[model samples]
Target: MRAAGFAPTTATYNVLIKAHCSDAAVPIDDAVRLFQNIAKPDVCSYNTVIDGLCRRGRLPEACDLFAEMIANGIAPTVVTYTTVIHWLAREACFDDALKLFDEMSGRGIMPNVVTYSSLIDGLCKGGRAASALELLDRMVRERKLPNTITYSSVIDGLCKEGRLGQAMEILDRMRLQGRKPDAGLFGKLITGLCDSGRALEAANYLDEMILAGIEPNRLTWSLHSKINDAVVKTLCAKGEVSRAFQVYQSMRTRGISTEPKTFHLLVECLSKKNYLEKAAHVVRDMLSERCIPERETWDTIVRAYWSKKKVRQEAEEMWSQLTVTN
Candidate 1:
């Protein structure tokens, strides 16, 4: 257009600046230079450049440009405040982010979900989940609905602090609000409950997670297996062998591999509880999976079977199979 003797207007320059900022191959400095050349920069021009600067980790320059935008008699919009707040939180400057949040509110600018989510995320990461909870409440009161990322950060933070009851409540609230909890969210709560010695509750949540239809992705498949093993092991330790067996069955049906130690514990516990048939079934499964049962586990199953005359032949066959497999 310039070669055709048509000077590019401010609107044309703004479009080019935004395109440059978004393209990784083009340096952000080019966008800044174009922005500087705009004779009459509007709010869009400043917002785009500020966002680009933030994306490049140039927070100080972004802030300075933000102040200059204001000094030029150009009023900053909600996008302006949110961009700065998001970057401030990402950089771990929670205090500065909060101050800006208050400043924006004082200026009668209503914060959107992105703004609240950013601050809540920052607070949660800073070990102030309690404060993040307060922000969540305030956000709801202000009629801004928290999305998955917002709730996830708060729940994870609460779990890390061992405030599991609150975490569960937030999870429930999230569900009621129509947000589907993913495998990672359930995994965090399960891990927290297990660490708190509340294996029974953890086991219940595991069932809920499966019932919720949250499919484990490649990244979370091992997480599901690990937590399932933990709940089964803890249940066995607590003498809840029946429940442990149920969970173990679920794991197998889902094609999740059981650890050798967990398999042994289940087999041993079933034998001790006089469930000789179940013990033998578990032993067969262990062998089929190529998991070598402990010698004590073999002794436990053999003794239980031998004590019952009705299954003495079964016991002898099991010993033969074990000998062959070994």
Candidate 2:
């Protein structure tokens, strides 16, 4: 419009304002300049600049602009107030955020779900989980349905804080309310459960994930491998060598391929059980399969035979074979 050498009317300017405000890469200063460049500013133009600044967490700048707009006889709209309030919440300036909310309500600008969710996210991040819970209740009381984004934010926060039980409750509530959890949300839950030593429950979710057509990625399998390896090693250290070998065999039969670290762990477990010959065989197979042994692998092999004087020559020959491939 400006390129056409035609002055934009207030509505046209408002359209430009909205366009510039939502563009993340466009700096607030550029938006302000565009508004100023207009021959006459309208409420929409002012609102757009204010919203852009507030959303970017420039509260003082937004407030200053709001004051200027009022002075210039441009009345603030509901969208204007909400944008500033959301910005305040993002900055964890809850007091200012709430104050603005009250002011907006007094001025007949009714708050909505966007307002509540902003504050809820802030509260959760501030470690005020109880306050966030209360805000969720308030949203319901205000007849605002919590959207998937709102619920997901709370769930993510809970998981990060290790509040898995509470997170699960929220997850159940979300499902009951007909909100399907996305893959990222489900993945977080699985990771949290596994980390908390609830692998049995994690296993159930794996099936649920498959049934829901959520493909498990490499990360999922990586976590599973770690948990299984830890359990197997624990069993082995407690003198359950047979059980440890069973675990290894199960991994092989299930096509759950492991890194060389798994083979190293197995070899260590076998050596501990006085199965040096079996351990040597495991090491040779690992090398024959072209799995690069770590420095620790060679150290383990050498040390396993060091205490027995009779097998020193055999250990040296095995070491030579291991180094040739490297």
Candidate 3:
């Protein structure tokens, strides 16, 4: 349009600034150039340039522009406050963020979900989960519903502080508000329990996760593997082969792959205890999962088959083929 001899409006500059800030190839300085060229730049122009500066991690420049906006007597909108507040919170400047929050409120820029979410996350990260929760209450009273990310940040803070029960309570409240807990919430809780050496409790949450149709990601699956591996090792060490097999079957039903050593331990223990039938089943499960047992594991199964049950010819042929392949 400018090339066509049409003078650009403030809205045009806003759009250009937004595009420059969002596109990596276009430097934010271009937006500032356009803003400077504007005969009468508007608040949107300033907001956009400030946002671009923030995105570029030039917060001092952004703050200077913000102060200029105030000096020019342009009322900052919620978007203006939110953009700066979120950036400040993210940079761990909770005190500055709080002051801005209060200042925005004083200006009657009633806080919205994004505004409170940033403040809540900032406070939580600053080891102020209690204050964060209190702010959550204030948010509720204002009829501004907190979203999943908001709840997850607080839950993560609670977990980090080892307040699992309080975290669960908050989760309950979030659910009651008709918001579904996503993977972040479950991951933090389960990870916390596992880190606390409460694998059994982690296992319980794993079950809840399955029931809730929350598919575990690679990290969550790896955590479950550790928990199940721990359970299997403990059971096998106590000579509870039946219980160990039960635990392994549970893992199998869920298609959870644990450490190969855990499977080897179970197979070796079962074979040595003369539970050749169960040991044979274990070997089959491992093969189906494409997890090849170690040589000692195979040898134990081979001995158990020959000594305890000479009638099992399939085991003999399988072990012979395995040996040839090895």
Best by lDDT: 1
Tens digit per residue, CA lDDT, model 3, 6-27: 9988888788878888887888
Backbone steric clashes in candidate 3, count: 0
The TM-score ranking, best first, is 1, 3, 2
Clashing pairs in 1: none
| Regions of candidate 1 where Cα sits further than 4 Å from its true position | 215-223, 237-239, 268-276, 290-326
Per-residue alpha-carbon lDDT of model 1 for 1-326, expressed as tens digits? 98999988889999999999999889999999999898999999999999999999899999999999999999999999999999998898888999999999998999999899988998888788988999999999998999999998999899999999999999999999899888778888888887888888989999998998865677888988888998998888888889889999998888888988888888889988998788898999999988888898899888887788767877788999999999
Compose the digit string of candidate 2's lDDT tens values, residues 51-126. Answer: 7887777779888988888788777887777777777777888877778777877878777888778777876776
**Clashing pairs in model 3?**
none
Q: Output the better candidate (1/2) by lDDT.
A: 1
Any runs in candidate 2 off by more than 4 Å, and if so which? 1-8, 15-27, 37-40, 55-57, 67-78, 105-108, 194-207, 217-291, 295-326
Give the C-alpha lDDT of model 2: 0.73
Q: What TM-score, computed on C-alpha atoms, does each candidate reach?
A: 0.83, 0.64, 0.76
Q: Candidate 3: where is the Cα deviation over 4 Å?
A: 1-7, 125-127, 216-251, 261-283, 295-326
Q: Name the candidate, 1 or 3, with the larger TM-score value.
A: 1
